[model samples]
Target: MSFPQLLTLLVIALHITGIVVATHAVMHTRTPQGAFAWALGLALLPYVTLLPYLYLGRSHFSGYITLHRSHRQRLSQASEGSELAGLPPSCTRYGALARMLQGTFHPGQQLRLLIDGEATFEAIFDAIAQAERCVLMQFFIFHDDELGRRMQKALLERAAAGVQVLVLFDGIGSHALPRHYVERLRQGGVAIHPFATQRHHNRFQLNFRNHRKIVVVDGWLGFLGGLNVGDEYLGLKPPLAPWRDTHLQMSGPAVMDLQRSFAVDWHWVTGELPPMLPPRPAQGDAYTLIAATGPADPQESCSLYFTVAINAACKRLWLTTPYFVPDQAVMSALRLAVMRGVDVRVLIPSRADHHAVFLASTLHAHDAIEAGIRIYRYQPGFVHQKVILVDDDTASVGSMNLDNRSFRLNFEIGALNVDRAFAADVERMLLDDFGKAVEITGDEYRRARYPRRLAMNVARLFDPIL
Candidate 1:
């Protein structure tokens, strides 16, 4: 056969393979829009779409799910005869949300709300300095910038002081994290690994990302929330300067659960559980539940967490997130909450970090405004906090955003605090944020340029994978 004929045959074979993948996507994609989009692109433009499909198409992390279920079973059997679960009785009210996450609302968690990058990094560094036994740190992004170097130095100091320090960062999120940044820590006796979904069966898949940011020191102190390790997180990056974010520091029995989450991810990456300190007694009186969810979950745990929290709101629900691409169920829940007379408000960034996400969020915000849910855009710098305030006695703070990535694809964590004082604190913080934000009026969408409006709707088409 002629060489050109053979080349044409190879091209046809690739197109056929793309079609087969598209068929699989049609069967497995969780949303109709995603299915149609993938199928169309794959069938018509195999050369362009096939490679992206390999990275972005898969919706399920079956490999991690199997490992998680097996490990949970073993852990359950091991703890069968241990003391009764320490979760408070009121936690049962969280219902299936709590069970699906396999966690309980343990009383006696002392939580300190860290308002911005400065406060968060200070608290984290102080805790690491005080670590007596071990320090476990994980972040979705770990830059080698000034702030990142500060964190590295602190961890190195602790490691040198006879503390066992281990760090885990997302392989994809921290892809640009230089090798020397990691080697510096390892050279100083700190053990570090990158969480990658590149195992044998999941080799071609890169959709799942470990987006949880957690820091545990001696199993007594824990930090989790929106701030990643970078100069940008410190408000040092121009244009996005004065970065607004939120993080929580917990000192109590609940830290054990946070540690467990880190251990699970660590085990997944290293095939061995890092040594954990025994549970310490309760250090505070606030009830806290660490809701860790990811693609491995049996259900859409993060989405349900938001829905449950929204449903639990009797009088108010105020949320702040950098991304506002809520899935159908969550959008429905917000609308229903408004219909039920709940004061629902959503705060999103006014500036664009990801132009596509910002555009998509504008449409979602307009939809929310039409449904009686007040939408506000932070006018100062970017608002990157993931916070939820429900009524008067419940609040959640962590890394889960109001987007599909957080809903199903990313490994996320949320600390749900059921306490009146914490709720009041959250309310005050949100009030200040709302003050800095401008309300999106009903006509805001109508006033947009036609081209920009068209772009937003086009961006919305990518919501499933956004």
Candidate 2:
């Protein structure tokens, strides 16, 4: 055939492949809207969308379930003779969300809420410096910035001092992280690996990211929440300055749960479990459960966990998240909570780090306000904390965001504390945050600039992936 004829044949073949992929999407996409969007893109704009879809369209995570099951079985066997096999009946009031996480309630945990990056990093660094046995650290975004270098120094110091250090970062989240950043730590005797999901079965599937930020020292002290190892997290970055976030530092049996989570991800990456020490004796009496959910789960565990927590609210439900694009179930639960005379409040950022997500969140805020749920935006800076307080005695803090990406796409974790004292602390912290935020009334969206309003609606269409 002539060159022109061959070009024509290639175009025809590409269109046919697009159609086949679109059909497959219609059958396997998680949401009807996602399916329709992909199908339309594939059929009408194959040249632009085909390659991107090949990487971003997948919903299931390969090889994760088998690995997770094996880990769960081993953990079960290890705890067979322990008294903490499960939570007491009194703890069942938190609902069945624990089962979804494959986590058990850990009692006698001393929960200390770290308000922002300064306090969080201070606590984390102190723990790492005090480490005698080992340090396991993980973050989705491990930036090569000032704060990241400080963290690197801390780990290197500990590693050089005869402390074993293992670091795992998300391959996609930290793709921009320089090789030398991690190489220096490895050279200092730190074991570092990327939690990658590019195996043969799920190659090109770049949607499932390990978004949990966990730091465990000596299998006893654990820290986790929204802060990553970046200058932005520390309010050191201009334009996103005065960053507002939250983290938790815990000791006692609860730390073991955090250690287990780290070990699971470590094993997934290196096929070797880190040392699992027995749970330390009870240090203080606070109940906490660690909920780790991801695309590997059979059901939407993160979404269900949020829904259950919202539904269990009798008096109030206050949440802080950078993103607010919740799924149908969670949205319904929020509306129902308001209808049942519960005070449902959502706190998001005034100026978001993500433009499309900020626009989508504005639309969600409008919907929430119409449903009688009060929405507030932090005024001084970005609010990146993932925290939820229910009624008077339940609160959660960790890396999960209030969006579809966190609900179904990311490997997320949350520490749910069911203690009145801890909940009160969370409430007080949120109250201060609310004081710094501006409440969104229905008029806010109605009076938005025409272009801004239009952009919001358009962005809402991308909620499934945002």
Candidate 3:
């Protein structure tokens, strides 16, 4: 065809594409409020409004992506597991998250808190050193610097000892990890899986990332928390300043649940499953359940879990997270709890990783503060850990943050601990953090800077999906 003829065909195809995209956008408006918000944003800024929608609008397709994804995963799961007696059946509690980890991930076990980062690191290294059967390590951000290099050496040492060592890192989160670093791991006979690569969109499963920072040693001892295996965690090299994070060094039967968590992700990344080392389930002090919420969840989201845990608080609630951009329901629960005279306290960072998210967090702080909710800003270092303590009777510690990103999109896991002593420790930790934190006053919230204020408001347009 001639140049002009080709141009005419291209324009026709472009118009058709635009029409299809517009149809999808309109169909995505579920609630009247959503429709109004979309209309308002599109009317105010026609072309630019699509920018935010592009990255966050994948869930609004024609099909029930949730069910379709479930069927696919079921097909994959069926081929792998046949033993019904040994597995917990991954049962669910009534009116809650699907029992994805019931019998298979037994949890009538002991729970131990790995308080200090250095101590946690020591526990992890020691676990690796002792792993006779298998070692599975997965982290969100694994730097190529000293800490990463040291881990490589240790994993190499383990692999050389005829132990099965498998390592997985997020392709995007650990993008800075050197190619040679991975090569060295392979050279030592360790299996390495990049959670997903960047080349293919299938590889770019960014939202459903394995955010649960887990390291299962011999399947009996598990380490999990906000601490990534890096210098900032070690206080060796600081990113956004010296980072302080929380972690769990758990033993007993609960370790199997964590092992199951890693196993699922491991199978997804690599067809072959990693062997988990754990003792057979016996009676123990801690009766626990590890909840994992992800993009495919249709019955419950992590937001639902947070809301339930927060609403369950009778006398006290203590929360700490780097970011605190809660969905309206969460903020309402906090306000209502405060209104009911519960001591609702939240600890957030003064200077977190994302300034815009921080601004967004303050937007909803007013009512809580006014209703007697106490807010604290950790002053010593960046507060990257996400934790919750309720009534000094129960607590949750894990990778989920107090933000919309964690609530809806990202894959996150956290342990729901109902033990009184564990709650006491969590409470004391919150109190200590409060002592170290500065307060965010009402005046500061009212008078946030222009760009931050603008960004928060702009981000609000997609809060339901964020």
Candidate 4:
């Protein structure tokens, strides 16, 4: 065939391939809405959807079009291994979620909530500086400011001293970082990789940004919480009012799970795979379960986790998120939990990063109040933390907001502690924040300004895409 005929044939083949792949993905996904969305995109933007799948789809048999297959394999391996290996002795009789997580990382896990941003930073930075072997980090925004530079300097020193170091930063999130930031680390022998580069504008790639903020060193120490690698996360300087956040510094067998996550993301950024976290004896008095959910599997795992946990709640459920635009499942579950007398309470930012989310959260919350679920809006500083305290024995903390973006698009890692003491501590911290918040009632809900109601409804319509 001539050039024109050849090109036409290629286009036809690619379009057919796109439909098959989209159909296969939707079938594997199982969610009707997700299937419709994927199929719709494939039908409308055939090339855009097809090209991304060839590279980023979950199929291993996709051949040259198989994108991130190695990374996906590493994720599956790490998730499965850590989930089964980390169960603490005290957690021998725990639930399925705990079991699955325990089968992955350390079972005996105790986590302390560091609420103050500065205090959280001190805990994390000290741990980073003390890392004896490799420091694995993946952050959404590694700003180019004072805190970012300070971290870069320390990471460089450690890497130069032959400490194994790998860092992953999101391309879009960390776009403002100095152009030479990665180069600076490269020159110091520290490897750095940007997740989802500009050349790959894969729709899901853009949607599934790594919102996880993780720090793991020597496979013995790991930090997960709200604070990103920035001055603002530390609350030293706030872009909008004073910043408030939380973090957890964990050492014990559970650290291995966090370490595993770091290693996988590190490998994705750099071509070289990092060492697996060797199993260790359980530490601490509490049973801890480490769980991660993301696009790597084409499953919205965090949202599913939330549903599972919420459904399992029989007594009480309390959630705090800076962003509160929850997915349909989450909303229904919370409402149902309340209807079942679970005493559901959701704490959201009285003032947050986006008016749309904040307002939509209020609307959902209005219904929650009517259903006997208490809702509070924190009016002090911005609550940049995300945490869920369920009943008397479990608490989950991580980078996930309750918003749709976190549940449907971005990657999130949450730590579930089965220790009563730790869970109580988290509950108390949440209660403390709740005390500083203003509770909303039906009367208050009815009194919302017309403009505000309009804005919130508009926001609700966009929640699916948030």
Candidate 5:
């Protein structure tokens, strides 16, 4: 065929392909806004939008949903007779959430609040050093920096001591992580793998990230929260230094739940279950449960988790997150909390590790303030902790950010504790953080220069996948 004829045929094929993709987007996209946006782009600009749609458009993960269900069923049967007699009265407040997640609040959990990277790492390292049987560790970002190397050393030592050590990190988040780093761990007898989301039929899907940070030692001790393994997380690197974060250390039956989460992810990656240890007896007085949510869930569990927590608040609801891009349901829950006379406060970072997300968060913060919700910017440094305090008896600390990515796209986990003492510790820590933060009015976004305001509005358009 002549060149002109060939060009015409190719153009027609492209348009047809675009229409087919647009149909898929309309049918499969989670939100109406997202579906509309994808459909419009795919139909109008096939050349530019086709590849991106394939990579990021799908809202559901392929094999994980089936794997998650079967695994959960197996785990449930395995622990049938070991469950606590009943939920504690304090935990009944989150009963709805528990039922939704098909999990129960495990009592007798001993929780320790680890503030900032130093304390978190010290405790994690100490636990690893004492590991007698196995260690299961996972992080979204596993940098090969000072702290990462330190973690590598600790895991290597444990592995050398004949302890089963397994590690998982996100492929995208740690794309820059050196191969030698992983090679050294593997060579040292550690079982390490990347949580590669693009597997089998999901090869084109790269948007779903495993953002959970969890560590389980000997099936008795567990650790999880916002901090990742990186020098910047340790506040050793600058520009956005003095990093602020929170982690939770726990013992008792709850640790088994955390370990279960790690096992599910491990099974997804390696197609085999990791070693499971018998549940230990109660270690303390706290009642806690691990909420693991992701795109594969039948419902948007992460968003619902926040929404339920917000709605349950009667007296006060304070939340801290590095990113503040909450979904409509969560935002609506916050507004309702305000209308119900709940003291609703949100803490975010003043620093911008991600410019687009920060701008979007600023706009959201403005909107929140207008609704009688208080927004504070942590002044000391980037406050990366994801925490929630409800009334005086419930608190949560975990890797789930208050953003669309965490709410609907990423695999995230958090430990919710129903205990006044643990909540008090979180409350005091937040009180100190609030002291260092400055509250912002809606005026901050309203009074911004037109260009900046326009950028923020533009950023808001990407909130679904942000």
Candidate 6:
């Protein structure tokens, strides 16, 4: 065929491919706005949009639902008739969330709030040092920096002591992580792998990330929250230094749930279950539940988890997250909380680790302020903790951010504690944080230069995938 004829045939094929992908987006995209945007771009500019759509258009993780369900059922059956304590009456506020997640809140969980990277890692390392049987660890980002080397040393020591150690990190988040870092761990007898989603037919699906940060030691101690293994998290890096974050340490039956979460991810990656131990006896009086949500879920469990927590608030609802790009349901829940006369406050970082997300968050903060919700920017440094305080009875600390990615795209996990004492600890910590933060108003957005405002508005258009 002539060059002109060949070009014509290729152009026609490209348009047809775009239409086919557009149809998939319309049928599979989680939100109407996302579907419409993808469809419009694919129809009008196939060359420009087709590659991106291939990478990011799908809302669900193919073949993960079946794995998740099978593991969930097996875990449920294994725990049946066990001596797992039931939730206390005061902890029932999160019963709806438990039901939605198909999880149960266990009583007698001892909780410790680990603030900042230093304390969190110290506790985690101490626990690993004491692990007699096995250690399961996962993080969204695992760097090969100072803190990462410390983590590597700790895990290597434990592995040398004949303890089974398994580690998982996100492929994309730790793309820059040195191969030698992982090689050293493997050579030291640690089982390590990246939590990759680009297996088999889903090679183009690079959007879904396993963002949960969890550590389980000997099936008795557990940890989860916002801090990842990096020098920046330790506030050792400049500019965004003095990093702020929160992590939870639990000792009780609840640790088994956290371990189960790690196991599911491990199974997904390695096609084999990691070593797990039976649930331990009650260690304290706190009721705790693990809410693990991701794209494979049939419902938006993470978004619903936030909404339920917000709706359950009668007196106050305070949240802290590095990112503040909430979905419509969460935003509506916040508005309703304000209308109900509840004190709704959100704490976000003033620093911009991600410019686009920060702009979008600024716009969302303004919208929230207009609805009587208070927004605060932490002034000391980046506040990367994901925490929720509902009244005086409930609090949660975890890796789930208050954003679309955490709500619908990423595999996130949080530990909800229904105990006044734990809530009080979170309250006091947040009170100190709030003291350092400045309350923002709609004027912050309204008074911005026209170009900045326009950028924010443009950024908001990408909220779904942000």
TM-scores vs. true structure, each candidate = 0.94, 0.94, 0.82, 0.81, 0.95, 0.94
lDDT of 1 by residue, 1-466 (tens): 9999999998999899989999998998877888999999899999999998888998765566778777666655654533236554445567567666666677788889999999999999988889999999999999998999999999999999999998999988998999999998999999999887555535566678999999998878899999999999989887988899999998887888888889888888888888788657887768887898887877889999999999888799999999999998999999999999999999999899999999999999998998899999898899999999988888899999999999978999989998889889999999999999999886888999999999999999889888
Which residue pairs in candidate 6 have backbone atoms (N, alpha carbon, C) closer than 3 angstroms, thus clashing? none
Candidate 2 at residue 56, lDDT? 84
Residue lDDT tens for model 5, 1-466: 9999999999899999999999999999999999998899889899999988877897765677788988767766765644445666667877778766778788898899999999999999999999999999999999888888999999999999999999999988888999999999999999999996656535676788899999999999899999999999889877888899999999998888888889888998898899989767996999887899988888899999999999999999999999999888999999999999999999999999999999999999999998999999999888899999999999999999999989888999999999999999999999999999999997898789999999999999989878
- Clashes per candidate (backbone, < 3 Å): 1, 0, 9, 17, 0, 0
Of 2 and 4, the candidate ranking higher by TM-score:
2
Regions of model 6 farther than 4 Å from truth: 1-16, 74-86, 201-203
Q: Each model's C-alpha lDDT?
A: 0.88, 0.87, 0.69, 0.71, 0.90, 0.89
Please write out the lDDT profile of model 2 over residues 103-157, one tens digit for every residue.
6778899889999999999999899989999888999999998898999999999
User: Cα lDDT of model 2 overall?
Assistant: 0.87
Instruction: Write down the lDDT that model 3 would get.
Output: 0.69
RMSD of each: 2.6, 2.4, 5.5, 6.3, 2.2, 2.4
lDDT of candidate 4 over 1-466, digit per residue (tens): 7999999998888778777777786775435665676677676678777655544343222221133445446555756545445454434333455433333434555466788767777776787778777888888899888888988998988887778888888877787888788898998898788875233344444455778888887777778877788877755665555776878877778787777666656555554678666544656776666776665544556787788778877788888888777777887888889778897888877775777777777787777777787888787778888888778887778888887667766767878777788888888788888898988788765887888788878777556555
- The parts of candidate 4 lying over 4 Å away from their true place are 1-105, 197-205, 237-239, 277-280
Kindly give the stretch of ten consecutive residues in candidate 6 with the minimal lDDT sum.
79-88
Deviation in angstroms for 386 in model 3? Answer: 0.9
- lDDT-better candidate, 2 vs 6: 6
**Candidate 5 residue pairs in clash (backbone atoms < 3 Å):** none
Clashes of 4: 17
RMSD after Cα superposition, model 1: 2.6
TM-score of 4: 0.81
Question: Which predicted model would earn the best lDDT?
Answer: 5
Model 2 C-alpha RMSD to native: 2.4
Clashing pairs in 1: 108-284
Instruction: Report the lDDT tens digits of candidate 3 across residue range 1-466.
Output: 9999998887666555545555565676544555556556554554555555565444433132434355436633753453232333222221233233222334455666766568778888888988888887888888877777878889999999999888888776787888898998898899997874222444323444557688877777777788887877876655556576788767777676677667766766666667867655655555455676655555436877788777777788888888777777788888888877888888887775765566566665654577677888778778788888878567778989887668766667787766677778887877777888877767665687887667767755555554
**lDDT of each residue in 331-392, candidate 6, tens digit only:** 99999999999999999999999999999999999999999999999998888999999999
Which is the winner by TM-score between candidate 3 and candidate 6? 6
